[model samples]
Target: MSGADLSRLSLNTATVKHADLRTAVDAAASAGYGAVGLWRDRVQEVGAERAARIVAEAGLRVSSLCRGGFLTAADDAGVEAALDDNRRAIDEAATVGTRELVFVVGGLSGSSPGGPPGAATDRDLVATRSRVADRLAELAPFAEARGVRIALEPLHPVFAADRAVISTLAQALDLAAPFAPGAVGVVVDTYHVWWDPELRAGVARAGREGRLACYQVCDWILPLASDALLSRGHVGDGYVDFAAVTTWVADAGYRGDVEVEIFNETVWDAPVAATVATVAERWERHVAPHLAPSPGAGMRLLDAPGERP
Candidate 1:
């Protein structure tokens, strides 16, 4: 894959979870990836400053930071803490040189920030979603101040009870509509949105609204792992029709980095280099050709003139 064109490819660090930040950055750059989507844990391993240095030295851009939201806290204290932590994440994202801070808004009322990983003490999905919107409003201005956008990521409906209350692109767009497109945006991850009947329309709306912040890819493999969160596979490994989805994204005018963010045990256990190589090959065969030929590049940010990147 040495001579392959990976100009728009991004390797999400979670796809190679076991590697240290330096190793992952080096591997991604060496594999011809133009960017990398970083997980907060990996960024914290060497501290945000040093992590930024590693990525910069490797010549790879930071596509987006993996996560900053879990805003469905049931109490005021929990809510405040979630907000503070997100503010920290925003700072981390800015320091790391990415304008998008991916958000996994909390699940039903009692999931993260209070209970066990997926335990929901209360099932008021409506209230939970309301709280997420309120929190986003509070954080948007702060995020915009530092040249960062809160890229809300809606999980697949299967994870709605415990992982995310925002389970569709339409819902994410609604939540983001109240803020500046640069300050709050939506992420279109294939693993999460591929099954939606409204995906094409939603992608178009995102494009029209200038809210398509990030685009991630992975297949929805069957025989889901005991932990459904790890069920993601490479681009062409399973049920996803990459060409179709990629075409919709291209038509929507999303020219940002297309990140490959797999979470499967098999891919995690394989050699990092081999996994990246496979992603590059699968992307070349299934996704590359579907992109726009030479439209204007880069997603437009908010009206905050100097910060749009």
Candidate 2:
């Protein structure tokens, strides 16, 4: 961005799901992206430290680790396993030099003793979410000790049945309230929260509470894909009013990484370079405008000495 000095955009590895970690980092850097978000699978492919090294060597920062939570489960063993996994994810985030670990808090508890994601018509969302809060409290100390914070991501409410029970910025903040803002906060992703009627209020509240850990940009498209998870699109390719939501985030005094996390097969199948290029271009056009030292001036969204968004 030396030419126009736009804000540095982060490429969530899932956006380029087809690429290996090394290749993804290379493509991101080559496309002039300054940061990246990593999933555990990709990190495990080359080991966590090495993955961190790969990104650092490429002169890129690891904005935030993709995830570390799924605390909703009907069985005690399954819950403990998720807790153990979260602890491991905390260690990985520390090694990767990112303080924020984005968590997709899980959905309905399964009817079987196995865990969630199975059909469970009798599940109780209230009880599941209550358990989510308890688990967050349990993990807060571990994350705080390692200097890693849990950034709860609010998936669309539709996903509340099978994905994350925390389905709104409002709900995430409530779960995060019991922990320190640094230990537990919320990820404001446009793709998920764009449709919320209380988006403005939620963004404002997140800002006021200093619970805005990350701001993810993506758009929603119709004609649902076979896998609904792949329904995200480039910023301008969908109906998301990025300017409005981004303004809400910026006005809330959030000075962190604005991660570009998408999950669409079309994007994944595209040439990685072009995908990164498209992400960069869209950030400049749709997102960057509402952020920075001054939105009107359109200064680059600076990542200087702040937590990764």
Candidate 3:
């Protein structure tokens, strides 16, 4: 990707969840990572305001917020509460000087209610996904008014019954369709979408529509973890075709940070600093080579900490 250094890499805090906000930011900056993707839980520990200051002081940009969704509530109050929470997520994004707030839109209504996994019929799934669209109708404007974009993230289909109903890049793009591209967009995460047969086309469509908000990278580990949710590996640790998929995304005209978001327990147990360094090295090896040249060359300035957007 045009003699790229570590300047374009971002480390998602989940890669080092063992560390607090300050520590994660420290490790990110120390490793020369340009940005970090944060989760709301991490921000709540130190508060968004303080967290923003810490990141600023470390000279690292907050690439994108982890989440702001769970729109599967069955009641009006539940729906309203979900929307309100997303609004607050938007405010947090603004306060932290970020433009993209990632949303992991939940699956079927009551699908995983009461802290246990649940199932739904086709009708239930359709209705629940429709509700998601309606909620977006409300949440998108709220975000746009404050100069924020709602980045809808489609989790792996394995999560379709309980985590996110949106299972593919095409689905995410469709949901983001009816709104201005800047107001509602989609996250192209390799861990979740790498297996999609239409991945290349979906990415190209996302770019053509101007709805490509963020590009996340992580290996899809096999022999899934007991809690498969934590099965993510470093960029090259598993079987994902880093070069092919990333080349598709880069060729689609995305010029933002390429975030390394791993969730493996083993990686978390290692020293956070070493973990960051290893991720950087792996990214440069397996991910960087596939990236197309940056879209605008040196014309885009690093406006927020170490990020371009």
Best by lDDT: 1
Q: Count the backbone clashes (under 3 Å) in each candidate.
A: 0, 2, 0
What is the per-residue lDDT of model 3 for residues 1-309, given as tens digits with 9 covering 90 to 100? 223487679888889988999899888887788898988999988889998999999998888988899987778998889988988899999888789999999866766622465453233788888888999998888899999999999899988877899999999988998999889999999999999999988987777777889999999988999888889988888889988888777766678888888888999999987898888889889988878745552233232122223
Higher-TM-score candidate among 1 and 3?
A: 1
Residue-by-residue lDDT tens digits, candidate 1, 197-290: 9998898778778788999999999998888899998888889988888888887777899999999889999999999899999989999988
lDDT tens per residue, model 2, 1-309? 434443367888989997999999998887777788899899989999999999999999888998988788757898899999999999999998898899998777763322344555447888888999889888999999999999999998768777788988898888888888889988999999999999988877777677788889999998877677888988999899998888888877777778898898888889988888888888888888778534532222232223234
Please list the C-alpha lDDT of all candidates, in the order they appear.
0.89, 0.83, 0.84
Candidate 1 regions off by >4 Å? 112-120, 293-309
Q: lDDT (0-100) at residue 182 of candidate 3?
A: 85
Residue pairs with backbone overlap in model 2: 214-309, 257-309
Model 3: which residue pairs collide? none
Identify the candidate with maximal TM-score. 1
Off by over 4 Å in 3: 1-4, 113-123, 293-309
For residue 259, give model 3's deviation from the true position in Å.
0.9
Evaluated against the true structure, the overall lDDT of model 3 is 0.84
Cα TM-score per model: 0.92, 0.91, 0.91
Ranking by lDDT: 1, 3, 2
TM-score of 3: 0.91
